[model samples]
Target: MQQRVLWSAVMVAALVLAGCGSAARPASPSGGPQQEQRKLVVWDWKSGEAATATYVEKVKADFAGRHPGVTVEFVAQPFDQYYTLLGTAAQSRKGPDVMLFNGGGQIRDRVDSLLPLEQHVAQDRSRLAGWDAFTKDGKIYAAPVTLQGHPIYYNKTLYEKAGLDPANPPRTWDEFVRACSAVKKATGAACLALGNKEGFGIQFFMSGLGSGILTPQEYDDWIAGKRDWSSPHVRRIFELWKEAGDKGLNSDGANSTAMFTDVFRVFESGKAAHIIGLMSDVGHWKDFGEFLPPDKLGVMRAPVVTGGATPSLPYDGGIGYAVARWTKDPELAADLVHSLTSADALAAFSSAAGAISSDTTIDVSRAGPAVAAIVPEIRTGRPALHVALSAKTLDLMGRLSQQLLSGSATVDKAVEQLAAADRAG
Candidate 1:
């Protein structure tokens, strides 16, 4: 009887040991649908090095708090190489789930790789402003983060030195040119700092010419081969470009000089009376306080050329965030985009980058004087020709401008080349 009882106890112990072994089996590594991890990766170029680092830290903390099982990783690159790097990563399908896209034709080039945010936008419409800019073929691919508008920034002291009233800025192209010529003749200052290296200075000049040279529909028609390149309006603008270069109103050696930094320095040093690039430069007058006094600065809309069709308006451009079509976690990617483009996030980003937010809900006053001066123009729907052109046309225009400015191509010849390139493209 005792031997039988001992045998029964041993059998029960063995059964308990088998049960423990089954319970200790490892879980599936693939997350098995029930325990999936939530995480996202984002790429942006606007954040300053130090500010981005700090902002990323805060984002991580905040995101983790809101999403107990999720994590976010951010990578910021320099502006010059940002797009190139993104293009490479996208081809390999290793790009960030969310990325910031610079406006212009380039946005069209990468449209296929981007996830349309229409559903997201429909769910959260107020987070967006100027949605028309990011729509292609009726699909929304990006959310505008800031209204990158260009306003003429001039030196108040230089205006006074040229015997011009500092309070009254030029309202027309003729007035602007005369004022510039006066400043150049009186104080030996450069009327404008231009560089062909970046193509922005020339593009800005062309945009200031307004709609007469090419209306949005005309430009589209030209690109589509319906309009002639040698149209009188087109020739007129080309002739005007040549005239500006010949009159000595632009920077010296602008054709060969890739010296954008020097150009900005010249403007800041009061040697150049005006700059017609980003509105942020006005704020830079304060950020780079030693370069120029904030109180000595003035802002105005880029003047309209005499015969242009569209009214003088501030041209706008900026970086936008889009999700990748092949992203493994679309929901998470959408969430990340939503967070970064939120009103609060935009306010923080604008403060960090010294830019204006695309969120109309955010107060433009928050961006301070420089950005505020241009807000009215943005809100009023001033048409800009450059922002309306297709990407291929823009590249051809850039090349043509470079050739024209370098004395390698005549105005008539450049126009022909541009038309030819448009045909080939």
Candidate 2:
């Protein structure tokens, strides 16, 4: 509800931001330089990272070549305050002309302030994947730069300590539990590395394991907003989430632990045997590979928990670039978004920053075994369950997840709250 309110606040406070836009100026005669040079600002969390230096450079180079008179400034905001800053900017009419956004509800809910990119990015439709994440009302609002997925990653050394074959991970929920149990008994390591301080743990947990719990059709329905929170399958997900904490599968102080680099460290340092990890950005194969041997980073599907449930990949469009509706030149901003997702620029992104380029055509065979494994499954992968939820519901889920972990809330109570939030959305 607070999220909805914040957006409503944006709509009310920034009425002019959405209502007015600068008209497109005619191109200079004989294709010469314009009378007035233009500048576009881009904001994102990734631009400041050392690994993304090449990605940023690539974007600037591509855009500069396309528009010599335009000056583009990159502002890398700290992610914790990203949305707050975005809201303030929208309200103040001082935000970037083009900005980065997470797919799903984050972008969808802000469409009142965004320019739809459907026609602008038509050429990229067939070349890139994960468009559904940034599309609402059949109109695309951004261009995806990377595809993100939750793949169960295990430490081969930890598997060996559990007396399990490193090459063959468990294929069923029962076997998975036994493996966790064995790891706990043999090495004193937590079975899984979990951090939920910000409630992101449950988000990863739902997406990472949802494939094994929900029937294929039910999974589709959930993504389509036909969620049945009280249904046995839906309730079962919450049940298992609680059960994992009760069983001591996750490391201690799980709720206090940050889900970002901290959770990845828990797995990298071998304090835990496994993690439900991302395909791109941090906490993934490349980040772990920097600390562990490439061969030791293993990717596995969600183990099946219910009869007839098929385990497949779950993912969404990671981060993407969007043009603001208030921009002086929507096409100019859209073109910058285009350059941001260009093949060469994204190829540099994949290799330089360890992101899985949304352009599936990019070869990742040499990235690592884990990525090699994840890429092949992208064709059949489904959007993550949490990604389908609205921002308000996600925040609610995060709180409920913590209560469930600490035995403070029953699965039923959590479901009821979520059902209400979902309906409100």
Candidate 3:
């Protein structure tokens, strides 16, 4: 694949460049050790956000205290161009010493350019819970800072207005459909707030509802890279996506809506009863809790569609930091990553940025009822289904998903394309 070829070529160039640089360093005429400059540049999209300011400051302070001589600079890039910029940096061997990454395929595809941080972060392994997302081939390339997962969030006020019991939510797919009908009939609100403009709705829907659609074996196999795109259950997922759109379960202009803050805003404004939301950062319990009463926000499991399916929480590392392999001091950079994931720093991040800290020891009981319901399921949660697919395949899926919504692409054709992509990889 393209990633493998790129990795091989990049690693070779990096090694050669590193070798030449080390050989070129001159020795002191008197044979005394020469002083070396200590500076580290870190890049991330979150650093510039207002909510993350305090968290970023805490991390910088902690890292500076631990590394007295090091001058650390944090470059905050726009999220839309983050990956493209990083790819260019990698190709040119001029990237930052440390950088942030989302877990799963994002970090996995770029592992060749990152220093494995397993040994460096061994001490905090027991305290953190999202390591699997940042690990590849038994090596940890990054330290997770937040736990992100899709949790079904509903508006209790909407439920009550629809003549449904706010105390109890639907437990099956049929029941969920019935509730949606009631919500639509009583209140003109849609059942779900869906935004697919960037093709993110299908990603959220697939992971958010996958636990309820696929059998345990099938689900595990998909995550393990043994996906069966033609499987009946897999087809069922696409069918449901189309069905939801055709039946008007989602709000108007679903395909034109954006996912990031817009999707959350729709749900927060009470335009829909349910949404597949995240556990941390933007579209989560904490964000919605600000608009709706904390008690009015409820979290529910994905309603079961297949007989053998069992709904468990779907999650992984939300975001993490990695040390670049080309850094002058890998250990020092890795140490900075460790500092970023420290308990105090993560706690500050969770508090100020509304993120679920990857550190399991952080208390989130006061976060709200939605978080309370989600945290308990983390122990049994599986990695999200979308996160397993490569970036190329994901992009393809997103495009196909749009056609599915508009009835331009049949489920069969979508599956065929996806199967071919998976096989090609």
Whole-model Cα lDDT per candidate? 0.67, 0.89, 0.89
Model 1 scores a C-alpha lDDT of 0.67
Assess the local accuracy of residue 394 in candidate 1 as a C-alpha lDDT between 0 and 100.
66
Question: How well is each residue in 1-425 modelled by candidate 1, as lDDT tens digits?
Answer: 99999999999999977776432223222212333547677888755465445445555655566677777767778878987887777666666878878765667667767888888767556655555566677788887776665556788888998999988888767898999988988899888877666555566666655443565556556434475666676677777777778888777877665535656666777777877656442224334345666567777765656444454444444667788875776667777777767666766666665666677666766444555566666665443446656666667777778777777888888878767766675
TM-score of each: 0.81, 0.90, 0.90
Q: How accurate is candidate 2 locally (lDDT)?
A: 0.89
Q: 1-425 in candidate 2: lDDT tens per residue? A: 99999999988989866766534222221223334439999999988988888888888999999899899999999998998888877766657989999999999978877888998999999999999999998899999999988999999998998899989999998999999999888888898899999999999999999999999999999998799887799888999999999989899999999998698999999999999999888899998997789999899999999988899999899999998776777778888999999999999999988888899999888988988989999999999999999989999999999999988999889999999999999
Instruction: Supply the TM-score for candidate 2.
Output: 0.90
Which run of 10 residues does model 3 get worst, by summed lDDT? 23-32
Q: Across residues 99-160, which tens digit of lDDT does each residue of candidate 3 receive? A: 99999889998887788888999998989888989999999999999999999999999999
Q: Taking the candidates one at a time, how many backbone clashes does each contain?
A: 1, 0, 0
